[model samples]
Structure formats: structure tokens, C-alpha cells
Target: MLTYLVSPDDSALDHYPLLGNALAFWRSTIQQRQPFCPACRASFAEEAQPAAFLFATAAIAPTSASVSAFCMACWNDLPPAMIEREATRVLQQVIPGGRFLDPCEARR
Candidate 1:
């Protein structure tokens, strides 16, 4: 009779160079964070039902990709050409604002 046995080795955590890079890749993905409407670009504060920048999210696979946010004011002020309705179903994965909808002073 013949038998096989398996042993666990956590040393793989740093057992090789390839293993190190793999750990970095996993950490990068899980630790990754994307903030929307950075204070430098927009405000998150609101009062008296002030307009809000609507945000959505989506999963994308690309090195150079971006996302946009839209306030009720910005949503209305945009030119028809700027708003990509086709992407409406898609969530704003990378909130950096691309093809903005523009903001307006008037209420809708």
C-alpha cells in the first residue's frame, strides 16, 4: 500500500520573490480606495436641501480610467453632448470627474 501526505508551509508568504510580488498585488487591490469629489474639486456638505452631486459606481478593467460626479445643478446645466446617457447604468468607479455636467446657479 502507498499513501501521500501534504504539509502546510506559510513560509510561502516570503518563500520567494514571486510570492512577495503576489502579496503586494493582493494588498494593493484590497487596500485600494477611491474618493469622490475631493474637497479641492467639490464639496460634500449640504444645507436646506442644497443640491447634491449624484455619484454612481462601476467596475472597469483598464489602467487609465476615470469617473464623474453630477450635482442636481451640474446635471441640469450640462450640454446634451456632454452627458453620456449610455453610461448612466454604469457606476462611477473612479470619481475624478470626466466630461463633467457643469454646475449652475439656478435651481431646477
Candidate 2:
């Protein structure tokens, strides 16, 4: 797997060389084109000022990747523990039977 960071200011073509600059190809084939808040199903079409982006490393795969976004209200109302719990819950649905390691456990 390849990992590259694309800054908001940087062009997608500049970063994803492996894609061979085929933005149209990637977009056309990509499923679930629209992103939404997992908890509230809020449409994330525009930039959310106070959003929480959760990357489920345990659920990362070529076929299925997991990213749970939470809106400002959910992010503000929920405690940190609750947020993590919810993210884990959502990820588990996407990655059934997938093992999730704690950050400390992964480090060691």
C-alpha cells in the first residue's frame, strides 16, 4: 500500500503519482462519493468548521476503508470517550472480525 499526504493547497495530481493523474478514473470508480457524518448523517459537502475526522486504521483496506466524520454538534456534545466508542462502533460495522489495537499496544 502507498501512503501520501495531499495538502489542501497542493494539487491531487501532484501527490498521487501512482494514480497516473487519472482523477476522472478514480472518481468514476470510487463508491460512496459523498461523505457524511456517521453519527448524524450530516452531509459533508462543504467544509465543516468544527468537525471531527476519525480514521479507522483497523478498517483500512484496498476494498474497504473507514473514515467516520462527526459534525460540530456531535463533536461538542459528546465526551472524548463517547466519541471514540462511537467511532469504534461504526468501524466494527465496516470491518467485521477486524482486530483493533490500542495506540500504546501498536507502538510496542
Candidate 3:
């Protein structure tokens, strides 16, 4: 898998969608179709495949700290920067003194 980012034109992004956080995607695959990395775009399995692969990224935004990671098969193309942004976005929505709920660990 490619360990670097591509410098494709902005238009390439239009053709290639960016998959968000991996865990979120996994939980809602039916809601959102998975995205393929532009560098790895392939239509025929018989043909060669791209060397680039995506990965899952977990981070705390604003603070910009990573918390977890997973490979493309297990995760989506969530970069560190994107993770930070998503984390910070979540933190923003959580009320400081409001009621919050955490699922039971046994349930998982």
C-alpha cells in the first residue's frame, strides 16, 4: 500500500469520494457506500490493482492527538488530520454539563 498522499487535482476528488472515519463507516455501511482511493481505483479484478491502501485513523481534534488505528480492510481512508477534525467536531456537540450516555461494555 502507498504510504504517502497523492497530489491529485481537486477535480480528482470529485471523481473520488473520501471515506470518513472507519468505525463510523463500518457501523453504517448500508447508509454510505465505501469509497476507493483514487490511486487504487480498479474496475476489473482480472487486471492489476493499485499499491495504495487506506486506513482508519482515530484522533482527538482541536487537541490534534491520535488515539487508534486500523488497516484499510478494517477501516476507511481516515487520515490523522481528518480524525482530529472529526474528534473536535464531536467534542463540540457534546454538552459540558449535560447528560451523556455510554453503552454497556458487556453489550459489545
Give the best candidate by TM-score. 2
Candidate 2, residues 14-50, lDDT tens digits: the string is: 5544332333333344345666666666665555432
Model 1 lDDT tens row, 20-48: 44334533443253322321233323311
Residue 29 Cα positional deviation in candidate 1, in Å, after optimal superposition: 21
TM-score versus the correct structure, for each prediction: 0.24, 0.48, 0.20
TM-score of 2: 0.48
Top-scoring candidate (lDDT): 2
- The C-alpha stretches of model 1 lying farther than 4 A from their native spots are 1-40, 47-68, 85-108
lDDT scores for all predictions? 0.32, 0.50, 0.31
Better of 1 and 2 by lDDT: 2
- Window of ten residues with lowest summed lDDT in model 2: 1-10
> Candidate 2 vs candidate 3: which has greater lDDT?
2
At residue 91, give the lDDT of candidate 1.
32
Question: Which runs of model 3 end up more than 4 angstroms from their true locations?
Answer: 1-76, 95-108
For model 3, how big is the CA root-mean-square deviation? 16.1
Q: List ranges where model 2 is wrong by over 4 Å.
A: 1-32, 46-50, 57-65, 97-100, 106-108
Encode model 3's per-residue lDDT on 45-103: one tens digit a residue.
22332222222222222311111222242124556565444434333344333221234
